[model samples]
Target: MKMNMFGLFNKKKSDTVSLPYTTDIHSHIIPGIDDGSPDVEHSVALVKQMQEWGVKRIITTPHVTEETFENTPETITAAYNLLKEALGEDAPEIIFSAEYRMDENFLKHVKNDILIPLPGNHILIENSFLQPFWDLKGLIYQLQLKGFNPILAHPERYAYYYDEKEIYTDIYNSGCMFQLNWLSLAGYYGKETRNIAYWLIEKGYVDFLGTDLHNRRHARAITEFLQTKEYRKLVEKLNLKNDTLK
Candidate 1:
């Protein structure tokens, strides 16, 4: 991934920038889970890193895709327990949730009421890159009827929707919230994602800002981004909904 001169500057901040949120509501830090930490030690390390970045709590979200991850509540809980045990007493508060993909299996789980949600019944959902879900609007309505507030994770990363901003507006109008990946602002993904992220922020459409932290590399990027002036301004300007999870 290419980054600008600002993102390349990695010196530790002389003055602290107060993080906007007391809690980070999205991540993949549970050990041995999906594509996140490979082991307990790495999971603990990531948690500590987030703590240093001023996040008081984290709700790690593992992928629960049908074809790939296929994670269940039982599996996620076991992993969370293992991570919690490894952290001992000094670690910040940790919670567990799943980033659900809108597929047949997800619909089954939704109907079964087996989904785990954030503090406010907020359930994170993502789309496939191949194509948008055909009934996304209806699905959001159904999720709301089932008492789950669906949050679209990293909407900027969906390149297909970039051509039409109204699609995002329609999704939001359907009662689904948007979560902006913190890495997007650092150009960790690319310039297109970065531009879309800022555009969403400018339109007051961003409801949450998440680390989406998977491993050390992503952690380092977030740490570097936080050191820059732009990141601090975003923290103030967006007024992200992460505080609601606290």
Candidate 2:
């Protein structure tokens, strides 16, 4: 597949260009695996775009819900292989993991081999959009007991926690890392999530930044984000965007 530059490989970005935080351990870029890239061509394109943004490695995380994605290790591996075949040897290092939803049956997945672990012992977790789990703390503790460090993806967007400012700190203190969606900082999830992303970053609570690149829509938000001076400056100033892999 031929690569087109959507400012992906263009490194002559302004001093305002914020580098990526780290390898995106959460994304739906795997074709048909989740709601991300539609097929092989689109997946390859997304990968090229990530490369242009200076992402050295990308762990494509397709969703694995008991009812929805249901992406087992075998299914995800097949998607990885297909993506590689499309990109050829020149493709970036593409790894496979999953974004697992924390549900009533989540504990069973933790016990079974159905769930995939994020790189470096991290487990990407998502909760409901309406309300947080009643046993949220216990669930996280269960994940910890299983020897996996759970990462709460897009913590700011959860509606229930918007009023409770300390929810972020409380969860983080419970041994979970926070992954902020790049679009949230750019107001993609609306003004509330955007403000929360900034708030968390300011408070030194956001450990990682994720593109959460679901599709072309998300791609557009990231493009806009890169053009901003603060976005570029924060990554370098705090050393949060580009230095975590070391």
Winning model by lDDT: 1
Cα lDDT tens digits, model 2, 35-91, are 788788778777877766777688778887767777788998888888889889898
Give the candidate number with the greatest TM-score: 1
Compared with the true structure, all predictions reach lDDT values of: 0.85, 0.75
Considering only N, C-alpha and C atoms within 3 Å, which residue pairs clash in candidate 1?
A: none
* lDDT computed for candidate 2: 0.75
Q: Give the 10-residue window scoring lowest on summed lDDT in candidate 2.
A: 237-246
- Predicted structure 1: lDDT: 0.85
Task: For candidate 1, report its TM-score.
Answer: 0.92
What ranges in model 2 sit over 4 Å off?
1-18, 236-246
Q: Which stretches of candidate 1 lie over 4 Å from their true place?
A: 1-18
Q: For candidate 1, lDDT tens digit of each residue in 1-246?
A: 642322322434443344578788889999886988888877877787777678888888999998888999999999999988878998788888889989998999998889989888999999997788889999999999988899999999999999999999899888899999989999999999999999999988899989898888887788777779887677667767787774
